[model samples]
Target: MNDSLDHDITAFLDTWTLDPNQTKSCFLDLKAHLDGLDGVRCEFVSRPGITYSLRAAHANQKKRGLFAMVDVIDDDPADRWLSVCFYNELVDDPKDMGDEVPGGLLGEDAKCFDMYESDDALLAYIKERLGAACHSASCE
Candidate 1:
């Protein structure tokens, strides 16, 4: 939310080391990538931060666990790049949790769990880990 913080953070990102700026750059890159996707903002769920994939949502329609939801936490003293991590959801089954999960979210595969700082990396996760999680009933 803080543009100035973003600026400083990005400055740190270019150094090729783990710093607060790396986190900012990562987030900024994400914002830019998601924005360019379909002209719609990548909805961010803060407090317990994460990213939602509208495209995946549309594709799956009735099914969620198709999109990406990155989880951010304050692991460091300053709370920067390393702390802001991402993870996708697995549907396992449509009826497993019903409406609790959002549309297009992916789940059901253990491999889906991974960390990323870029949209591209996140996308790879969807194709790999989350993509494998089947509808909950299948597990039953």
Candidate 2:
């Protein structure tokens, strides 16, 4: 995307809210496209448009966390793109949560904030910033 366009998206997402309802909307949209997909979780998470996450359903795959990876494909005949939100990186195993934190409460290990580009031109920029690994993704 052009510099101006990228700026515009950033400006828009700056105020984006990851409301529960919108998260559900994103998840449903992804489901319609991917088959045999499960454990989908979506959220705006301060990112532009609809954003999402989930956990790998294949107990042994080891794509641990709430979001393991994400994918995006062009939507036919539309000004939009479809996003596949896989794994919710926001889930910390009960044993990892803080000393007194409840199993249901999210700990630092479970929170993730990151974004990707569905547009190739902009994607290159993202990849650059992402470097060798997904950017802004960390939990220790």
Candidate 3:
């Protein structure tokens, strides 16, 4: 990881208040999956807890790039979970993946999912969605 990403990730871990063990492992696993996706870049976002946003680095125009996000929710500490949120206005939910919750939990036009499994199928699903977001022509 680059210095900025490393620093951001470290900061993210430092702020987590849940089961440090599971939180770290899950976050690492999720990061690994995001790293595997083509043109996708992940960054840490500090809020009530640690969260992340994704973008398409290859997109020539910033407005045409992706703005999907992933969040680590440590609400219960013992039963912490991660959420993958999509900008509903810029992306469609053809698969109806994540639960459509209020934007306060994530951001505007968000579709959030608490991904508890890091299996291949789930990762592929996430990649597909993220890919669509990255390749969107009308991201604005």
Candidate 4:
């Protein structure tokens, strides 16, 4: 992440009211994982009262601007959840944990995993998917 992008993310996170469900921590974990990936860059997009998203892409990716999107779904400001999405082809869902959304990710079919509470098992699965997506994006 660049300095400006980091600042933006920090600002958004700082102002966000933390939920008891630990969604904030989940988002932070995902962001940290992305930050450790080689050649990966991320940008933060905030649509107050709607959503705050972290869109990430690998340097070698060409088919899409982002390989993954981590969104803080703010439908209910008092209780925010998470929606993590990836291009359908970029990650595998062998465990059938994700929901298939038609054209959900930047107009492309996507596999999305929604998290309402902090679940270690689910978080681990999502992290594995993130690794797979980043690797696939890097090869493109």
TM-score of each: 0.38, 0.21, 0.65, 0.97
Off by over 4 Å in 2: 1-50, 53-56, 66-78, 83-140
lDDT (tens digit, per residue) of candidate 4 on 58-79: 9999878999999999888779
For residues 1-140, what per-residue lDDT tens digits would candidate 3 score against the true structure? 56888887787667555563454565576577667656666555555534344333433436534466666665655566667776676457677777777663345557765666445565567667766665662334
Model 1 gets an lDDT of 0.35
Q: Count of backbone clashes for each model?
A: 25, 13, 1, 0
lDDT of all predictions, in order shown?
0.35, 0.30, 0.59, 0.93
Q: Write the per-residue lDDT of candidate 1 for residues 24-63, one digit (tens) a residue.
A: 4554554454444432223433332322222222233344
Error at 33, model 1, angstroms: 0.4
Alpha-carbon error at 79 in model 1, in Å?
Answer: 3.9
What CA RMSD would candidate 2 show? 14.7
Model 3: per-residue Cα lDDT at residue 96: 78
Worst 10 residues of 4 by lDDT: 10-19
Give the residue spans of candidate 4 off by over 4 A: none
What residue runs in model 1 are displaced by over 4 Å at the alpha carbon? Answer: 1-21, 39-41, 48-56, 82-140
Candidate 1, TM-score vs. the true structure? Answer: 0.38
